[model samples]
Target: MNDESWALSPNTRKPLPQLIEDKIRQLIDSGHFKAGDRLPTEPELAQKMAVARSSLRTALQRLQLQGIVEVMRGRGWYVRSTSVSDRDESLVIDSRISDSDLMEVRIALEATAASLAALRADDGELDEIAKRAREHQGASTEDKEELLQTDEEFHAAVVKASHNELLEQLYRSLVPKLRGYRRNSYGSAELHNRSANDHNQVAWFLKRRDEGGARTAMTTHLLGLYNDLATQAGTAAGERAELNTFAWEDEPRWRDR
Candidate 1:
């Protein structure tokens, strides 16, 4: 790719990372870059685009999150196979359960669980949640299975810390139902990073014994996942608009208390 092709006007509205992301996507879409092709090194891309390495990395991370490219440690970035084979079973889980339905129940259960965990979890339990969060964050994006495993463990640790056997039991029962949804939503590197960050926030609050903060953090985290899944499900425009605004945006009833 020519450096001139990457030149952006000072008046450009988008952030540098987003601009670079769009440029790279265009290149891939136009076949200038194809599956299995290696992208230029970070230094080369930064120089050619006249952007900082950080910005270039952000763009590449976004691409990786979109499954457009993947990174191999010690090697450069490579475009990944986005093609769906006829035998693809990525979404072959129980069709009776919709993501929104699952998320609705999760928000109710896990948010309360997070709050209870903040009040009840001992130092060791809190440390376990923190450890799981860091493990998920450090897990390589190339290993989707490991990444998802770490994520699940992190959530499981949080629920277990709540010391509520009923909540834990319900959550354990729901775990199998969540596997397909996890595979569907946790595809990109960016989403993985976001989840890790949210987990960190949840852990932070739990450690501080901040019940409200823990609950809010957990709710916000799950809401983000719910919104992502809803958007990807291709709802109508009006419904999409509604879905974008979460119910929590309204004033909390407890505010009057």
Candidate 2:
């Protein structure tokens, strides 16, 4: 089809699901939307992409199930996975389950995660992990903001350590809401320090290419952090950042990449 013809006539080639999914993914990858940023409503997205609302919803549901996007009861979908926000944010597993039950699930999920990562992590991804850790190493105490940023970096790496897309996506969704809550109300450094050593040890293990060590270290690391945070705070305050406060970076990470 000619270019104008194609633009004027609805796309008749690709499946509607694939079309909407690709458009949404492009918007995300292009930095038109960002991690934690809410997407346009399903109707809006469908109109923007020229697809049926049902197809758009299906695409969003797929993204949500895959962990790249998250759906709140009335809030709509948000971008969840990214290199920066994932760590600074704390993890929040969805549940009616008790902390103990969640811990068991984490053990099974993260252990297998490390094993797969040991085999799958590419050199480039590993380098990214190391870079974030170094950012943590030099983070100044006076730089609470930087420290918070670095802390997120560190956890984001561990989530990355699993080398599984779903794991990264899941942790991304959970961590930010968790961390944002802590930052908003109590600002608990004592609670954060409690988990730093485990984070350090896990980072060291992954760097060493010790699969067994990585698996065990990460498992314990997450559980300990979970307990420490759980003791301090169990639920997000149900707040969101003011638009001016965490303004979308004018030049975001993705534009050049």
Candidate 3:
């Protein structure tokens, strides 16, 4: 594999570590490397990716935390699996685990992530989250694939900013299940843009280090998904009433245009 192929775009707004992370993930996804394949040493990888070792290490730590790759003592990093999560893809498809089930888990994990990120994220991390939110907000609604990818990146950046590896990993594990449902639901630009606005709200709070505000914003954002699922399943009225009993005192704007 050509190391120069991993060169990052100068125009990209993503942080250096994130850019490195994306490049490595892309290489793995494209089959340049596979599970159990050994990756180059730290120095080699940094040189190849044209990034500082600190940035490369940070990227690798995120990947390793998510179970994408494994590090061996006295040896080197190795690709663990190409799949985003180790969770069985069939579990999400078999209907044994409903999208609502995953949604509840996501709400809990992500709200906490946003709150912690607010307390801990550096300026660079905050900037990345804001950049992703804007990208998603302006994403073309007609292009389902592009919209989904942008949305994914925004959420991922938020979770990563939490600086809690375990929390980030747990959230990443839910991505595979969430993607299919989200793709089906993005039927209009309005919906996509609204979600993007929610992302911005979360980022805004994080930038100001307002933990409670960030948490509320994230919960509000996710409740949008809950609303859609409940409506589709004919449980909107009952389920939404039940959801409001949580810590978020404000009525959810699930139906707000």
lDDT of each: 0.73, 0.56, 0.77
lDDT for 47 in candidate 2 is 61
Tens-place lDDT digits, model 3, residues 193-233: 78988988998889899988898889888887877886786
lDDT of 3 at 142: 85
RMSD to true structure for each model, in Å: 13.7, 16.8, 9.3
Clash pairs, candidate 3, are none
How does model 3 fare in lDDT?
A: 0.77
How would you encode candidate 1's per-residue C-alpha lDDT over 1-257 as one tens digit per residue?
55677675464786676788788876777787778899889998888778887567656755553446766757989987445331122324466867666776777788899999999998988988999899989988876656666777788778878888677656655655776678566678898889989999999999999988898888888878767777778755455322222347531122110
**True-vs-predicted CA distance for residue 95, candidate 3, Å:** 5.1
**Model 2 lDDT tens row, 23-123:** 66656666767788987787766666666675566566545544567665468888876443343234545556444344445545666676566667777
Alpha carbon lDDT of residue 180, candidate 3? 69
Q: Which stretches of candidate 2 lie over 4 Å from their true place?
A: 1-108, 142-144, 181-194, 233-257
Q: Whole-model lDDT for model 2 versus the true structure?
A: 0.56
Quote model 1's TM-score. 0.57
Off by over 4 Å in 1: 1-95, 237-257
